[model samples]
Target: MPLTDTDRGAMLSVIGASSVDDLFVDVPEAARLSGPIAGLPNHASELAVERHMTALARKNTVAGEVPFFLGCGAYRHHVPASVDHMIQRGEFLTAYTPYQPEIAQGTLQMLFEFQTQVARLLGTDVANASMYDGSTACWEAIGMARRITKRGKAILSSGLHPHYVSVAKTMAKYTGDALATSAPTLTAETDIDALIAAIDGDTSCVVVQYPDILGRIADLTPLADACHANKALLIAVVTEPVALGAIRSPGEMDADIVVGEGQSLGVGLQFGGPYVGLFGCKDKYVRQMPGRLCGETVDADGKRGFVLTLSTREQHIRREKATSNICTNSGLCALAFSIHMTLLGEKGLRDLAGLNHALAVQAAERLAQVPGVSLVNDAFFNEFTVTLPVEARPVVRTLAERGVLAGVSLGRLYPGEDALANGLVIAATETTTAEDIETLATALQEVLA
Candidate 1:
């Protein structure tokens, strides 16, 4: 039933509240918007609003309309038709977080399968249901390491994504922790020795990115050992999980925590967000982990089932004791990742990863043939940086006008950081074709000329 004015008034009277304004007495009046925002129309019919948004959307150029090569954190990978159809089967789409174990077997089982898949892919013992996205997952991982080691300092590699580093800095500032991050390295590989030198007794974790921001792949075995020797944890962040199929798993190298973005598996880029954060760690440290966890069990009837096993880290557990304020999982996106991975098993994932690498190499080689362009990283999976004679930003803008979504500019990722401003980071996923590579090369030649 729709609530009436009398119903609201009676409820407020019972609580001894005079009005809605009285309920917000604690909120500062100066901080609140006085009325409707300026410039925006006061109100509009639902149909009119839909029409306006639709018209605006039509004016924008979508990835489907062009040969897309832009991949920094998000990639343009092919998702199977069956996976999409299976996820929207009403049972999966219309469900909420599986808080009730008995009635939520389906969701719990899916999350359990997801955790298993992530654990296997990352080569870790356990994984959570999911987190907000890759950046937050990295941030949480630093905190997790601190709690486990009872230390206050974190050492971050410069090759980590700028946004991820920024998030970590913000989180550390709030917690009164110390963070030492390296300056951005333009070369392909990370300086493991330099990273280890920064670690001290008070260091809780050493954070490094696999297939880092510049698309340089680091083995991370030596650095992981150094952290362990120093009584610190190694938090490995993988922005592209697909890179794992070809590269060594972080766990094999003694990574205490492995976090990544699972968007490449099943989720679409969807502008910038709604991506899944992949978090996995050793079984021993599961209690210190954030977010929800699903486990296998048997009911009184002796039937096998899945249930929410560990949930002591959310907001409901009291702010002071809670591991994190993150209460919900990116259930639907995680389901998409699981569905896609299930469709491709182990062998299929490896083959797909190989294809992406080959495609990227082909693209990089072709672009290198352009008079003034050169590939920066000799060791990369599907994404690599290119040194352009001219600044990459204006060239990218010109290519967009020519209907090719070329690649992301390094300047965009590191705005005032001028050293990398001339370099362009290009990615080629399984979706990229020979023709796409040719188109990009041609656009660069023309734009540079």
Candidate 2:
């Protein structure tokens, strides 16, 4: 049933083309690949392909296999087996966006619960279903602020994760918004006064990371007050949602918008993502929020039900009037997050957070004993920064060779910044053990020696 060359020639003639290459006339020659991609085996059997892929997979040193400490944004936390089992149920696993509320009650109800959980956890009045991930949610918060405040400027805190900052800057470039970012702070604390000074009349929002990239926890009340005085919105970013269980909610500090990564909850790192973005804001600003919102209702018989409350994306509205170009929610990942949170009720979450902090303290005390290492943060939640005597990147490599998965190197995040080259960001979840801490400390001592 395949078309022959003569048939192809006739089709090309009908389209007024001489050859297959003519169809690509709009593509510049320099941008085109010269030939087939290198290193691709030709027509391998299924068995051979499986073998090759397995061999490639073996090269990765998984977190569970080693004494792992690496946490910059993504983390390694224990996901209960029940979460996986519940999410994999046929009803939830293959479900898509609940565009038709009548037939999609189950999906809509789950999203409603997800929104409720995120709203309560963040202490905000309302939360959308979910966004792509934490970084995109951060970018959308900036845009929403601009809409609400009618301003063009945003101030990014120095302690914000570099990856999140980059995503915001990229979005700003096309939207023509001004992003004034502070220089990276390598110390245990953020320069709050500098952030306050940066806010002015044209500022739309001030973005600060709670339990920021370096793992230092900051009370955003003063910063939030400063932003409100300038008629600017305060956007509090949380990279680790689990921290919310122990710390004061951003809403309590009067933040106008709260955005964060939900990866640490039910979601696994999965080699950087397929993660969920948690977005919540004040009730007054709900109309301007990006993504979808689900709400509970009563049916004809007065039975409870759920429906899509608001969908402001272009697909559901006039393209010119849409609140966001983001089309859909991360439905499955959000389901996983909600199920996990349900398993760990308020008390369970707090207990888990406390255990994480206790483990982190043990790791910090052990690491501080190493001759060439110094602890950076005076106060931290489940993670802390350490200053090593030598560049941390090479030391991390050496540790890996010694069969230990050490923490993330600051130099890896902020490349070419000499001041941060010796900084290391380490984390300890409930999964971290005393033996793991000892392994890291021993390996670090030997490496530095």
Model 2 misplacement above 4 A: 1-19, 30-35
Q: Cα deviation in Å at residue 352, candidate 1?
A: 0.9
lDDT of 2 by residue, 1-449 (tens): 39999999999999999998888889999987777678875578899989999999999998898999989888899999999899987666733677777778878888888999999999899999999999999999999999999999999999889999999999999898999885566776676778998889999999999998899888889999999999999999999999998999999899999999999999998999889999999999999999889888999999998888789989899998888999876788899999999999999999999999999999999999999899999799899999999999999998998889899999999998999999999999999999999999988998899
lDDT of each residue in 1-449, candidate 1, tens digit only: 38898998999999999886887878898987778799999779999999999999987879876889888889989999998898887656633577677777777888999999999999899999999899999999998888899998988888888899999999888998888875576776566778988888899998988888888887788898888899999999998899888988998888989999999988888988789999999999999999878899899999998888887665557778878888787889999999999999999999999999999989988998999998889889999999898888888888988899989998888888778878998999999888889988988898888
Displacement of residue 58 (Cα, Å) in model 2 is 0.4
Give the alpha-carbon lDDT of every model: 0.88, 0.91
Candidate 1 Cα RMSD (Å): 2.7
What is the overall TM-score of model 2 with all chains considered together? 0.95
How far does residue 206 in candidate 1 sit from its true spot (Å)? 0.7
TM-scores for candidates 1 onward, in order? 0.92, 0.95
Q: What C-alpha lDDT, on a 0 to 100 scale, does residue 416 get in candidate 1?
A: 80
Q: Give the clashing residue pairs of candidate 1, or none.
A: none
